[model samples]
Target: MSLGRYVGRRLAITVPVLVGVTALTFSFVHLLPGDAVDAIVGFRDVSAETEAAIRAEYHLDQPVWDQYLLWLRDAITLEFGESPVTGRDVSATIGRRLPATLALGGAAWLLALAIGIPAGIVTAVSAGKPADEVGRLAALAGIATPNFWLGLILLFVFSVRLGWFRVLPPDAPLVSLATVKFLVLPTITLGTAAAALVMRLLRSSMRRELDAPYVTAARARGLPERTVILKHVLRNAFLPVVTVAGLQLAFLVDGAVVVEGIFSWPGMGRLLVRSILRRDYPVIQAIVLVIGIAIVLANLLVDIIYAILDPRIRY
Candidate 1:
Protein backbone atom coordinates (compact mmCIF):
# COMPACT_ATOMS: atom_id res chain seq x y z
CA MET A 1 0.00 0.00 0.00
CA SER A 2 0.97 3.63 -0.43
CA LEU A 3 2.21 5.56 2.57
CA GLY A 4 -0.85 7.75 2.75
CA ARG A 5 -3.17 4.79 2.47
CA TYR A 6 -1.27 2.91 5.16
CA VAL A 7 -1.33 5.87 7.54
CA GLY A 8 -5.05 6.34 6.95
CA ARG A 9 -5.73 2.68 7.63
CA ARG A 10 -3.73 2.69 10.87
CA LEU A 11 -5.47 5.84 12.05
CA ALA A 12 -8.85 4.32 11.30
CA ILE A 13 -7.92 1.36 13.46
CA THR A 14 -7.13 3.73 16.33
CA VAL A 15 -10.64 5.23 16.46
CA PRO A 16 -12.27 2.25 18.13
CA VAL A 17 -9.28 1.71 20.38
CA LEU A 18 -9.61 5.30 21.55
CA VAL A 19 -13.33 4.88 22.14
CA GLY A 20 -12.72 1.76 24.18
CA VAL A 21 -10.11 3.61 26.21
CA THR A 22 -12.65 6.32 27.00
CA ALA A 23 -15.38 3.87 27.95
CA LEU A 24 -13.08 1.84 30.14
CA THR A 25 -11.50 4.88 31.78
CA PHE A 26 -14.90 6.38 32.51
CA SER A 27 -16.20 3.17 34.01
CA PHE A 28 -13.12 2.41 36.10
CA VAL A 29 -12.74 5.98 37.37
CA HIS A 30 -16.38 6.06 38.45
CA LEU A 31 -15.91 2.75 40.24
CA LEU A 32 -13.40 4.37 42.59
CA PRO A 33 -14.47 4.64 46.21
CA GLY A 34 -15.75 8.24 46.24
CA ASP A 35 -17.27 10.79 43.89
CA ALA A 36 -15.91 14.31 43.27
CA VAL A 37 -18.58 15.68 45.58
CA ASP A 38 -17.35 13.55 48.43
CA ALA A 39 -13.82 14.69 47.78
CA ILE A 40 -14.94 18.31 47.76
CA VAL A 41 -16.93 18.04 50.99
CA GLY A 42 -14.67 15.68 52.85
CA PHE A 43 -14.92 15.46 56.66
CA ARG A 44 -17.39 18.32 56.74
CA ASP A 45 -21.03 18.21 57.77
CA VAL A 46 -23.30 19.49 54.98
CA SER A 47 -27.07 19.55 54.70
CA ALA A 48 -28.61 16.69 52.66
CA GLU A 49 -29.98 19.20 50.16
CA THR A 50 -26.56 20.81 49.69
CA GLU A 51 -24.89 17.46 49.01
CA ALA A 52 -27.62 16.52 46.56
CA ALA A 53 -27.22 19.86 44.77
CA ILE A 54 -23.46 19.30 44.45
CA ARG A 55 -24.03 15.88 42.89
CA ALA A 56 -26.59 17.27 40.45
CA GLU A 57 -24.34 20.17 39.45
CA TYR A 58 -21.45 17.89 38.58
CA HIS A 59 -23.76 15.34 36.87
CA LEU A 60 -22.69 12.74 39.41
CA ASP A 61 -26.38 12.07 40.00
CA GLN A 62 -26.77 10.69 36.48
CA PRO A 63 -26.72 6.99 35.76
CA VAL A 64 -23.31 5.53 34.73
CA TRP A 65 -24.39 4.88 31.14
CA ASP A 66 -25.88 8.37 30.80
CA GLN A 67 -22.70 9.93 32.16
CA TYR A 68 -20.58 7.89 29.74
CA LEU A 69 -22.66 9.00 26.75
CA LEU A 70 -22.49 12.65 27.83
CA TRP A 71 -18.76 12.45 28.36
CA LEU A 72 -18.19 10.64 25.07
CA ARG A 73 -20.18 13.27 23.21
CA ASP A 74 -18.16 16.16 24.56
CA ALA A 75 -14.92 14.19 24.24
CA ILE A 76 -15.53 13.68 20.50
CA THR A 77 -15.22 17.44 20.08
CA LEU A 78 -12.08 17.54 22.28
CA GLU A 79 -14.19 19.29 24.87
CA PHE A 80 -13.44 17.68 28.18
CA GLY A 81 -15.52 19.58 30.69
CA GLU A 82 -14.22 21.61 33.62
CA SER A 83 -12.69 19.85 36.58
CA PRO A 84 -15.27 19.57 39.36
CA VAL A 85 -12.60 19.99 42.02
CA THR A 86 -10.65 22.94 40.53
CA GLY A 87 -13.26 24.46 38.20
CA ARG A 88 -10.61 24.93 35.50
CA ASP A 89 -10.86 23.91 31.86
CA VAL A 90 -9.35 20.46 31.57
CA SER A 91 -7.55 21.18 28.30
CA ALA A 92 -6.04 24.40 29.56
CA THR A 93 -4.78 22.72 32.71
CA ILE A 94 -3.20 19.91 30.72
CA GLY A 95 -1.68 22.38 28.28
CA ARG A 96 0.03 24.22 31.09
CA ARG A 97 1.63 21.10 32.55
CA LEU A 98 2.35 19.25 29.29
CA PRO A 99 5.56 21.08 28.43
CA ALA A 100 7.28 19.91 31.59
CA THR A 101 6.38 16.31 30.93
CA LEU A 102 7.50 16.62 27.34
CA ALA A 103 10.76 18.18 28.35
CA LEU A 104 11.48 15.46 30.87
CA GLY A 105 10.52 12.67 28.50
CA GLY A 106 12.47 14.15 25.62
CA ALA A 107 15.65 14.58 27.64
CA ALA A 108 15.43 11.06 28.95
CA TRP A 109 14.90 9.72 25.42
CA LEU A 110 17.95 11.50 24.07
CA LEU A 111 20.08 10.30 26.94
CA ALA A 112 18.94 6.74 26.40
CA LEU A 113 19.80 6.82 22.70
CA ALA A 114 23.17 8.45 23.30
CA ILE A 115 24.21 5.92 25.91
CA GLY A 116 22.56 2.84 24.51
CA ILE A 117 23.67 2.98 20.87
CA PRO A 118 27.34 3.46 21.66
CA ALA A 119 27.29 0.87 24.40
CA GLY A 120 25.58 -1.61 22.15
CA ILE A 121 28.20 -1.05 19.43
CA VAL A 122 31.02 -1.53 21.91
CA THR A 123 29.56 -4.71 23.42
CA ALA A 124 28.84 -6.21 20.01
CA VAL A 125 32.37 -5.47 18.75
CA SER A 126 33.95 -6.85 21.89
CA ALA A 127 31.75 -9.89 22.33
CA GLY A 128 32.93 -12.50 24.92
CA LYS A 129 35.38 -10.00 26.44
CA PRO A 130 35.32 -8.42 29.90
CA ALA A 131 33.82 -5.19 28.56
CA ASP A 132 30.86 -7.07 27.11
CA GLU A 133 30.35 -8.99 30.33
CA VAL A 134 30.48 -5.81 32.40
CA GLY A 135 28.09 -4.06 30.05
CA ARG A 136 25.65 -6.93 30.27
CA LEU A 137 25.76 -6.94 34.05
CA ALA A 138 25.24 -3.20 34.21
CA ALA A 139 22.29 -3.44 31.85
CA LEU A 140 20.75 -6.15 33.99
CA ALA A 141 21.12 -4.04 37.13
CA GLY A 142 19.65 -1.03 35.42
CA ILE A 143 16.62 -3.01 34.36
CA ALA A 144 16.17 -4.48 37.83
CA THR A 145 16.34 -1.17 39.71
CA PRO A 146 13.09 0.64 40.52
CA ASN A 147 12.63 4.21 39.31
CA PHE A 148 11.50 5.69 42.64
CA TRP A 149 14.32 4.05 44.57
CA LEU A 150 16.87 5.23 42.03
CA GLY A 151 15.44 8.75 42.12
CA LEU A 152 15.65 8.81 45.91
CA ILE A 153 19.21 7.50 45.93
CA LEU A 154 20.31 10.06 43.37
CA LEU A 155 18.50 12.77 45.32
CA PHE A 156 20.11 11.78 48.58
CA VAL A 157 23.61 11.34 47.19
CA PHE A 158 23.77 14.26 44.78
CA SER A 159 21.44 16.71 46.43
CA VAL A 160 21.99 16.02 50.08
CA ARG A 161 25.51 14.64 50.46
CA LEU A 162 27.51 15.85 47.47
CA GLY A 163 25.58 19.13 47.10
CA TRP A 164 25.71 18.79 43.34
CA PHE A 165 22.00 19.28 42.60
CA ARG A 166 18.85 20.37 44.39
CA VAL A 167 16.57 18.03 46.28
CA LEU A 168 13.58 19.61 44.56
CA PRO A 169 13.39 20.75 40.97
CA PRO A 170 13.41 24.50 40.40
CA ASP A 171 10.53 26.54 38.98
CA ALA A 172 12.21 27.69 35.79
CA PRO A 173 11.31 27.99 32.15
CA LEU A 174 11.88 24.92 29.98
CA VAL A 175 14.72 26.30 27.86
CA SER A 176 16.93 27.50 30.66
CA LEU A 177 19.96 25.85 32.28
CA ALA A 178 18.13 25.75 35.58
CA THR A 179 15.58 23.43 34.06
CA VAL A 180 18.32 21.21 32.63
CA LYS A 181 20.00 21.06 35.99
CA PHE A 182 16.74 20.13 37.65
CA LEU A 183 15.98 17.45 35.11
CA VAL A 184 19.26 15.56 35.38
CA LEU A 185 18.33 13.21 38.20
CA PRO A 186 14.77 12.56 37.16
CA THR A 187 15.82 11.98 33.56
CA ILE A 188 18.47 9.51 34.62
CA THR A 189 16.02 7.74 36.89
CA LEU A 190 13.35 7.50 34.24
CA GLY A 191 15.63 6.63 31.30
CA THR A 192 17.97 4.05 32.80
CA ALA A 193 15.70 1.05 32.37
CA ALA A 194 14.84 2.01 28.82
CA ALA A 195 18.49 2.54 27.99
CA ALA A 196 19.35 -0.88 29.32
CA LEU A 197 16.65 -2.49 27.24
CA VAL A 198 17.82 -0.75 24.07
CA MET A 199 21.43 -1.70 24.73
CA ARG A 200 20.69 -5.40 25.11
CA LEU A 201 18.47 -5.55 22.07
CA LEU A 202 20.90 -3.64 19.88
CA ARG A 203 23.81 -5.76 21.04
CA SER A 204 21.97 -8.91 20.12
CA SER A 205 20.85 -7.50 16.79
CA MET A 206 24.34 -6.37 15.85
CA ARG A 207 25.88 -9.70 16.83
CA ARG A 208 23.44 -11.48 14.54
CA GLU A 209 24.13 -9.04 11.72
CA LEU A 210 27.89 -9.41 12.18
CA ASP A 211 27.61 -13.14 11.49
CA ALA A 212 25.57 -12.62 8.30
CA PRO A 213 27.01 -13.64 4.90
CA TYR A 214 27.02 -10.01 3.66
CA VAL A 215 29.20 -8.94 6.58
CA THR A 216 31.59 -11.84 5.76
CA ALA A 217 31.61 -10.70 2.11
CA ALA A 218 32.36 -7.11 3.16
CA ARG A 219 35.24 -8.29 5.34
CA ALA A 220 36.63 -10.57 2.60
CA ARG A 221 36.65 -7.50 0.25
CA GLY A 222 39.35 -6.01 2.56
CA LEU A 223 37.12 -3.16 3.84
CA PRO A 224 38.28 -1.49 7.03
CA GLU A 225 36.86 -3.08 10.17
CA ARG A 226 35.22 0.20 11.21
CA THR A 227 33.71 0.69 7.78
CA VAL A 228 32.40 -2.88 7.61
CA ILE A 229 30.72 -2.59 11.02
CA LEU A 230 29.42 0.96 10.83
CA LYS A 231 28.44 1.08 7.14
CA HIS A 232 26.96 -2.39 6.94
CA VAL A 233 26.25 -4.29 10.16
CA LEU A 234 24.96 -1.38 12.30
CA ARG A 235 22.42 -0.24 9.72
CA ASN A 236 20.73 -3.61 9.46
CA ALA A 237 20.79 -4.11 13.25
CA PHE A 238 19.17 -0.73 14.00
CA LEU A 239 15.61 -1.54 12.97
CA PRO A 240 14.74 -3.47 16.12
CA VAL A 241 16.24 -0.70 18.25
CA VAL A 242 13.94 1.78 16.51
CA THR A 243 10.96 -0.43 17.30
CA VAL A 244 11.89 -0.64 20.99
CA ALA A 245 12.50 3.09 21.27
CA GLY A 246 9.03 3.75 19.94
CA LEU A 247 7.42 1.43 22.47
CA GLN A 248 9.49 3.00 25.23
CA LEU A 249 7.34 6.10 24.88
CA ALA A 250 4.62 4.25 26.73
CA PHE A 251 7.08 3.08 29.41
CA LEU A 252 8.29 6.65 29.84
CA VAL A 253 4.73 7.80 30.47
CA ASP A 254 4.13 5.10 33.05
CA GLY A 255 7.49 5.70 34.77
CA ALA A 256 7.02 9.46 34.72
CA VAL A 257 4.13 9.09 37.15
CA VAL A 258 6.42 7.72 39.83
CA VAL A 259 9.52 9.73 38.89
CA GLU A 260 7.62 13.03 38.82
CA GLY A 261 5.97 12.23 42.11
CA ILE A 262 9.30 11.41 43.73
CA PHE A 263 10.91 14.66 42.64
CA SER A 264 7.80 16.79 43.19
CA TRP A 265 7.82 17.81 39.53
CA PRO A 266 4.73 19.70 38.36
CA GLY A 267 3.82 17.67 35.28
CA MET A 268 0.81 15.77 34.01
CA GLY A 269 1.96 12.66 35.84
CA ARG A 270 1.91 14.46 39.18
CA LEU A 271 -1.37 16.07 38.25
CA LEU A 272 -2.73 12.65 37.29
CA VAL A 273 -1.88 11.12 40.64
CA ARG A 274 -3.42 14.06 42.47
CA SER A 275 -6.54 14.04 40.30
CA ILE A 276 -7.03 10.31 40.79
CA LEU A 277 -6.74 10.72 44.55
CA ARG A 278 -9.30 13.53 44.60
CA ARG A 279 -11.58 11.83 42.10
CA ASP A 280 -11.22 14.65 39.56
CA TYR A 281 -13.06 12.83 36.80
CA PRO A 282 -12.61 15.26 33.94
CA VAL A 283 -8.88 15.71 34.48
CA ILE A 284 -8.34 12.00 34.90
CA GLN A 285 -10.26 11.11 31.76
CA ALA A 286 -8.66 13.83 29.66
CA ILE A 287 -5.10 12.91 30.66
CA VAL A 288 -5.70 9.23 29.94
CA LEU A 289 -7.22 9.99 26.53
CA VAL A 290 -4.29 12.23 25.65
CA ILE A 291 -1.87 9.45 26.63
CA GLY A 292 -3.78 6.96 24.49
CA ILE A 293 -3.60 9.28 21.50
CA ALA A 294 0.10 9.80 22.09
CA ILE A 295 0.77 6.05 22.09
CA VAL A 296 -1.19 5.59 18.87
CA LEU A 297 0.73 8.39 17.19
CA ALA A 298 4.02 6.95 18.39
CA ASN A 299 3.21 3.59 16.87
CA LEU A 300 2.30 5.25 13.58
CA LEU A 301 5.57 7.10 13.57
CA VAL A 302 7.39 3.83 14.23
CA ASP A 303 5.78 2.20 11.21
CA ILE A 304 6.80 5.12 9.05
CA ILE A 305 10.34 4.89 10.34
CA TYR A 306 10.43 1.17 9.62
CA ALA A 307 9.54 1.74 5.99
CA ILE A 308 12.14 4.48 5.71
CA LEU A 309 14.90 2.37 7.25
CA ASP A 310 14.12 -0.86 5.38
CA PRO A 311 12.51 -0.44 1.96
CA ARG A 312 11.53 -4.09 1.98
CA ILE A 313 8.98 -3.38 4.72
CA ARG A 314 5.42 -3.11 3.41
CA TYR A 315 2.32 -1.39 4.72
Candidate 2:
Protein backbone atom coordinates (compact mmCIF):
# COMPACT_ATOMS: atom_id res chain seq x y z
CA MET A 1 0.00 0.00 0.00
CA SER A 2 1.10 3.61 -0.60
CA LEU A 3 2.28 5.53 2.46
CA GLY A 4 -0.50 8.10 2.18
CA ARG A 5 -3.17 5.45 1.85
CA TYR A 6 -1.72 3.49 4.78
CA VAL A 7 -1.68 6.57 6.98
CA GLY A 8 -5.23 7.52 5.98
CA ARG A 9 -6.51 4.07 6.83
CA ARG A 10 -4.74 4.11 10.18
CA LEU A 11 -6.18 7.52 11.05
CA ALA A 12 -9.66 6.40 10.08
CA ILE A 13 -9.39 3.33 12.28
CA THR A 14 -8.23 5.45 15.22
CA VAL A 15 -11.64 7.09 15.59
CA PRO A 16 -13.50 3.91 16.42
CA VAL A 17 -10.63 2.71 18.62
CA LEU A 18 -10.68 5.92 20.61
CA VAL A 19 -14.47 5.68 21.03
CA GLY A 20 -14.04 2.11 22.22
CA VAL A 21 -11.34 3.19 24.69
CA THR A 22 -13.49 6.00 26.06
CA ALA A 23 -16.55 3.79 26.44
CA LEU A 24 -14.69 0.82 27.89
CA THR A 25 -12.66 2.91 30.31
CA PHE A 26 -15.81 4.77 31.38
CA SER A 27 -17.77 1.59 31.95
CA PHE A 28 -15.02 -0.19 33.90
CA VAL A 29 -14.21 2.74 36.18
CA HIS A 30 -17.87 3.20 37.07
CA LEU A 31 -18.58 -0.50 37.58
CA LEU A 32 -16.11 -0.81 40.46
CA PRO A 33 -18.96 -0.82 43.03
CA GLY A 34 -19.14 2.93 43.77
CA ASP A 35 -19.59 6.35 42.19
CA ALA A 36 -17.22 9.30 42.46
CA VAL A 37 -19.25 10.86 45.24
CA ASP A 38 -19.28 7.68 47.28
CA ALA A 39 -15.50 7.43 47.02
CA ILE A 40 -15.19 11.06 48.21
CA VAL A 41 -17.55 10.67 51.21
CA GLY A 42 -15.43 7.82 52.58
CA PHE A 43 -18.21 5.43 53.68
CA ARG A 44 -20.16 8.21 55.41
CA ASP A 45 -23.91 8.87 55.31
CA VAL A 46 -25.31 11.40 52.84
CA SER A 47 -28.60 13.29 52.66
CA ALA A 48 -30.93 12.53 49.69
CA GLU A 49 -30.58 16.15 48.50
CA THR A 50 -26.80 15.93 48.70
CA GLU A 51 -26.81 12.67 46.77
CA ALA A 52 -29.04 14.18 44.11
CA ALA A 53 -26.79 17.23 43.85
CA ILE A 54 -23.69 15.11 43.41
CA ARG A 55 -25.41 13.01 40.77
CA ALA A 56 -26.51 16.13 38.93
CA GLU A 57 -23.04 17.68 39.08
CA TYR A 58 -21.46 14.75 37.24
CA HIS A 59 -24.51 13.88 35.11
CA LEU A 60 -24.35 10.53 36.87
CA ASP A 61 -28.12 10.34 36.67
CA GLN A 62 -27.91 10.01 32.88
CA PRO A 63 -27.95 6.65 31.12
CA VAL A 64 -24.62 4.84 30.71
CA TRP A 65 -24.37 5.20 26.92
CA ASP A 66 -25.52 8.84 27.04
CA GLN A 67 -22.88 9.60 29.67
CA TYR A 68 -20.26 8.04 27.42
CA LEU A 69 -21.50 10.05 24.43
CA LEU A 70 -21.31 13.27 26.44
CA TRP A 71 -17.76 12.51 27.54
CA LEU A 72 -16.80 11.55 23.99
CA ARG A 73 -18.33 14.75 22.62
CA ASP A 74 -16.39 16.88 25.07
CA ALA A 75 -13.17 14.95 24.33
CA ILE A 76 -13.55 15.44 20.59
CA THR A 77 -13.82 19.18 21.27
CA LEU A 78 -10.81 19.00 23.69
CA GLU A 79 -12.90 19.90 26.70
CA PHE A 80 -12.05 16.99 29.00
CA GLY A 81 -14.39 18.10 31.75
CA GLU A 82 -13.67 18.87 35.44
CA SER A 83 -12.23 16.61 38.06
CA PRO A 84 -14.69 16.13 40.91
CA VAL A 85 -11.79 15.21 43.19
CA THR A 86 -9.87 18.46 42.76
CA GLY A 87 -12.42 20.79 41.15
CA ARG A 88 -9.89 21.48 38.40
CA ASP A 89 -10.49 21.16 34.68
CA VAL A 90 -9.33 17.71 33.65
CA SER A 91 -7.58 19.03 30.58
CA ALA A 92 -5.72 21.58 32.64
CA THR A 93 -4.75 18.97 35.18
CA ILE A 94 -3.23 16.73 32.49
CA GLY A 95 -1.51 19.58 30.67
CA ARG A 96 0.25 20.59 33.85
CA ARG A 97 1.49 17.10 34.67
CA LEU A 98 2.24 15.85 31.16
CA PRO A 99 5.60 17.55 30.65
CA ALA A 100 7.20 16.02 33.70
CA THR A 101 6.26 12.54 32.53
CA LEU A 102 7.44 13.27 29.01
CA ALA A 103 10.72 14.63 30.30
CA LEU A 104 11.36 11.56 32.38
CA GLY A 105 10.29 9.22 29.60
CA GLY A 106 12.40 11.02 27.01
CA ALA A 107 15.42 10.86 29.23
CA ALA A 108 14.88 7.15 29.77
CA TRP A 109 14.49 6.35 26.07
CA LEU A 110 17.55 8.39 25.09
CA LEU A 111 19.67 6.73 27.73
CA ALA A 112 18.46 3.34 26.62
CA LEU A 113 19.19 4.03 22.97
CA ALA A 114 22.59 5.47 23.73
CA ILE A 115 23.66 2.56 25.89
CA GLY A 116 21.87 -0.32 24.19
CA ILE A 117 22.77 0.39 20.57
CA PRO A 118 26.47 0.70 21.32
CA ALA A 119 26.49 -2.48 23.35
CA GLY A 120 24.60 -4.22 20.60
CA ILE A 121 27.06 -2.93 17.98
CA VAL A 122 30.05 -4.03 20.04
CA THR A 123 28.52 -7.43 20.76
CA ALA A 124 27.77 -7.90 17.09
CA VAL A 125 31.35 -6.96 16.15
CA SER A 126 32.82 -9.21 18.84
CA ALA A 127 30.43 -12.13 18.60
CA GLY A 128 32.33 -14.95 20.28
CA LYS A 129 33.10 -14.68 23.99
CA PRO A 130 33.94 -11.90 26.48
CA ALA A 131 32.01 -9.05 24.90
CA ASP A 132 29.09 -11.30 24.06
CA GLU A 133 28.82 -12.71 27.60
CA VAL A 134 29.02 -9.27 29.22
CA GLY A 135 26.41 -7.80 26.90
CA ARG A 136 24.08 -10.74 27.44
CA LEU A 137 24.49 -10.45 31.22
CA ALA A 138 23.64 -6.77 31.24
CA ALA A 139 20.60 -7.40 29.10
CA LEU A 140 19.53 -10.26 31.32
CA ALA A 141 19.74 -8.21 34.50
CA GLY A 142 17.79 -5.37 32.92
CA ILE A 143 15.08 -7.64 31.55
CA ALA A 144 14.77 -10.01 34.50
CA THR A 145 14.47 -7.43 37.22
CA PRO A 146 11.30 -5.53 38.07
CA ASN A 147 11.29 -1.71 37.92
CA PHE A 148 9.89 -1.10 41.41
CA TRP A 149 12.67 -3.07 43.07
CA LEU A 150 15.32 -1.33 41.03
CA GLY A 151 13.83 2.04 41.96
CA LEU A 152 13.85 1.23 45.66
CA ILE A 153 17.41 -0.01 45.56
CA LEU A 154 18.46 3.16 43.79
CA LEU A 155 16.54 5.27 46.30
CA PHE A 156 18.09 3.53 49.29
CA VAL A 157 21.61 3.70 47.90
CA PHE A 158 21.50 7.20 46.51
CA SER A 159 18.91 9.12 48.50
CA VAL A 160 18.70 7.60 51.96
CA ARG A 161 22.22 6.32 52.34
CA LEU A 162 24.35 8.75 50.36
CA GLY A 163 22.24 11.85 51.02
CA TRP A 164 22.52 12.73 47.36
CA PHE A 165 18.83 13.52 46.73
CA ARG A 166 15.52 13.52 48.50
CA VAL A 167 12.64 11.14 47.95
CA LEU A 168 11.09 14.19 46.33
CA PRO A 169 10.48 17.31 48.36
CA PRO A 170 6.92 18.54 48.23
CA ASP A 171 7.74 22.26 48.11
CA ALA A 172 10.77 22.37 45.84
CA PRO A 173 10.40 23.88 42.36
CA LEU A 174 10.55 21.38 39.51
CA VAL A 175 13.11 23.31 37.45
CA SER A 176 15.73 23.33 40.15
CA LEU A 177 18.73 20.97 40.22
CA ALA A 178 17.34 19.39 43.37
CA THR A 179 14.32 18.10 41.46
CA VAL A 180 16.54 16.76 38.71
CA LYS A 181 18.49 14.95 41.37
CA PHE A 182 15.24 13.43 42.61
CA LEU A 183 14.37 12.24 39.11
CA VAL A 184 17.62 10.30 38.67
CA LEU A 185 16.61 7.12 40.46
CA PRO A 186 13.26 6.82 38.75
CA THR A 187 14.82 7.55 35.38
CA ILE A 188 17.43 4.86 35.91
CA THR A 189 14.76 2.39 36.87
CA LEU A 190 12.73 3.14 33.75
CA GLY A 191 15.77 3.37 31.48
CA THR A 192 17.24 0.07 32.52
CA ALA A 193 14.13 -1.79 31.41
CA ALA A 194 14.08 0.03 28.10
CA ALA A 195 17.78 -0.56 27.62
CA ALA A 196 17.33 -4.30 27.84
CA LEU A 197 14.64 -4.21 25.20
CA VAL A 198 16.71 -2.07 22.83
CA MET A 199 19.79 -4.22 23.22
CA ARG A 200 17.93 -7.42 22.38
CA LEU A 201 16.16 -5.93 19.40
CA LEU A 202 19.28 -4.26 18.00
CA ARG A 203 21.42 -7.33 18.50
CA SER A 204 18.91 -9.66 16.91
CA SER A 205 18.30 -7.35 13.98
CA MET A 206 21.98 -6.63 13.38
CA ARG A 207 22.90 -10.29 13.60
CA ARG A 208 20.30 -11.17 10.99
CA GLU A 209 21.35 -8.34 8.69
CA LEU A 210 25.04 -9.30 8.95
CA ASP A 211 24.09 -12.67 7.48
CA ALA A 212 22.10 -11.15 4.61
CA PRO A 213 23.35 -11.65 1.04
CA TYR A 214 24.01 -7.92 0.48
CA VAL A 215 26.27 -7.73 3.51
CA THR A 216 28.16 -10.85 2.44
CA ALA A 217 28.61 -9.41 -1.09
CA ALA A 218 29.89 -6.10 0.31
CA ARG A 219 32.40 -7.92 2.52
CA ALA A 220 33.48 -10.08 -0.41
CA ARG A 221 33.96 -6.95 -2.57
CA GLY A 222 36.57 -5.62 -0.08
CA LEU A 223 34.32 -2.95 1.46
CA PRO A 224 35.46 -1.76 4.90
CA GLU A 225 33.79 -3.65 7.73
CA ARG A 226 32.51 -0.44 9.36
CA THR A 227 31.15 0.84 6.05
CA VAL A 228 29.42 -2.44 5.29
CA ILE A 229 27.80 -2.49 8.74
CA LEU A 230 26.88 1.18 8.94
CA LYS A 231 25.83 1.75 5.32
CA HIS A 232 23.98 -1.48 4.71
CA VAL A 233 23.06 -3.03 8.04
CA LEU A 234 22.10 -0.48 10.71
CA ARG A 235 19.26 1.13 8.79
CA ASN A 236 17.12 -1.96 8.35
CA ALA A 237 18.18 -3.22 11.76
CA PHE A 238 16.88 -0.11 13.52
CA LEU A 239 13.53 0.33 11.80
CA PRO A 240 11.67 -1.96 14.17
CA VAL A 241 13.83 -0.78 17.05
CA VAL A 242 12.60 2.74 16.47
CA THR A 243 9.00 1.60 16.64
CA VAL A 244 9.64 -0.37 19.83
CA ALA A 245 11.25 2.63 21.45
CA GLY A 246 8.31 4.79 20.48
CA LEU A 247 5.84 2.39 22.05
CA GLN A 248 8.05 2.21 25.13
CA LEU A 249 8.08 6.00 25.26
CA ALA A 250 4.33 6.02 25.64
CA PHE A 251 4.58 3.57 28.55
CA LEU A 252 6.93 5.97 30.32
CA VAL A 253 3.91 8.22 30.80
CA ASP A 254 1.84 5.88 32.94
CA GLY A 255 4.09 2.87 33.50
CA ALA A 256 6.18 4.85 35.94
CA VAL A 257 3.26 5.22 38.32
CA VAL A 258 4.84 2.89 40.86
CA VAL A 259 8.28 4.50 40.60
CA GLU A 260 6.75 7.98 40.86
CA GLY A 261 4.83 6.90 43.93
CA ILE A 262 7.95 5.38 45.44
CA PHE A 263 9.97 8.56 45.06
CA SER A 264 7.04 10.97 45.40
CA TRP A 265 7.93 12.53 42.08
CA PRO A 266 5.38 15.01 40.73
CA GLY A 267 4.47 13.50 37.33
CA MET A 268 1.46 12.17 35.43
CA GLY A 269 2.09 8.71 36.82
CA ARG A 270 1.71 10.07 40.34
CA LEU A 271 -1.37 12.03 39.34
CA LEU A 272 -2.87 8.86 37.84
CA VAL A 273 -2.53 7.16 41.20
CA ARG A 274 -4.36 9.99 42.93
CA SER A 275 -7.14 9.89 40.36
CA ILE A 276 -7.48 6.16 40.77
CA LEU A 277 -7.64 6.39 44.57
CA ARG A 278 -10.38 9.01 44.42
CA ARG A 279 -12.26 7.06 41.75
CA ASP A 280 -12.16 10.21 39.63
CA TYR A 281 -13.92 8.90 36.55
CA PRO A 282 -13.63 11.94 34.35
CA VAL A 283 -9.96 12.38 35.14
CA ILE A 284 -9.24 8.69 34.59
CA GLN A 285 -11.24 8.57 31.39
CA ALA A 286 -9.52 11.66 30.04
CA ILE A 287 -6.12 10.30 30.94
CA VAL A 288 -6.90 6.99 29.26
CA LEU A 289 -8.05 8.71 26.09
CA VAL A 290 -4.97 10.90 26.02
CA ILE A 291 -2.74 7.86 26.42
CA GLY A 292 -4.60 6.10 23.62
CA ILE A 293 -4.06 9.07 21.36
CA ALA A 294 -0.39 9.25 22.32
CA ILE A 295 0.16 5.59 21.44
CA VAL A 296 -1.56 6.02 18.07
CA LEU A 297 0.47 9.14 17.34
CA ALA A 298 3.67 7.39 18.38
CA ASN A 299 2.97 4.46 16.08
CA LEU A 300 2.19 6.89 13.25
CA LEU A 301 5.45 8.66 13.95
CA VAL A 302 7.27 5.33 13.77
CA ASP A 303 5.73 4.62 10.40
CA ILE A 304 7.04 7.93 9.15
CA ILE A 305 10.45 7.20 10.57
CA TYR A 306 10.49 3.81 8.88
CA ALA A 307 9.63 5.39 5.55
CA ILE A 308 12.43 7.88 5.97
CA LEU A 309 14.96 5.19 6.81
CA ASP A 310 13.87 2.75 4.11
CA PRO A 311 13.06 4.73 0.94
CA ARG A 312 11.59 1.68 -0.79
CA ILE A 313 8.62 2.20 1.52
CA ARG A 314 7.77 5.55 -0.10
CA TYR A 315 5.68 4.01 -2.84
Find the candidate with the highest lDDT and give its number.
1
Query: Looking at model 1, how many pairs of residues clash?
Result: 0
State the lDDT at 203 in candidate 2: 88
> How do the residues 120-229 of candidate 1 rate in per-residue lDDT, one tens digit apiece?
99999999999999999999999999989999999999989999998887777788898889899999998898889899999999999999999999989999999999
Clashes (backbone N, CA, C under 3 Å), per candidate, total 0, 0
Per-candidate Cα lDDT values, in order, are 0.84, 0.80
Quote the lDDT for 286 in model 2. Answer: 76
lDDT of 2 by residue, 202-300 (tens): 988898888889998999999998999888898879887998988986676664788777877668888887888777777887778778777767777
- State each model's C-alpha RMSD to the native: 3.3, 3.1
Candidate 2 wrong stretches, greater than 4 Å: 1-5, 29-57, 60-66, 169-172, 311-315
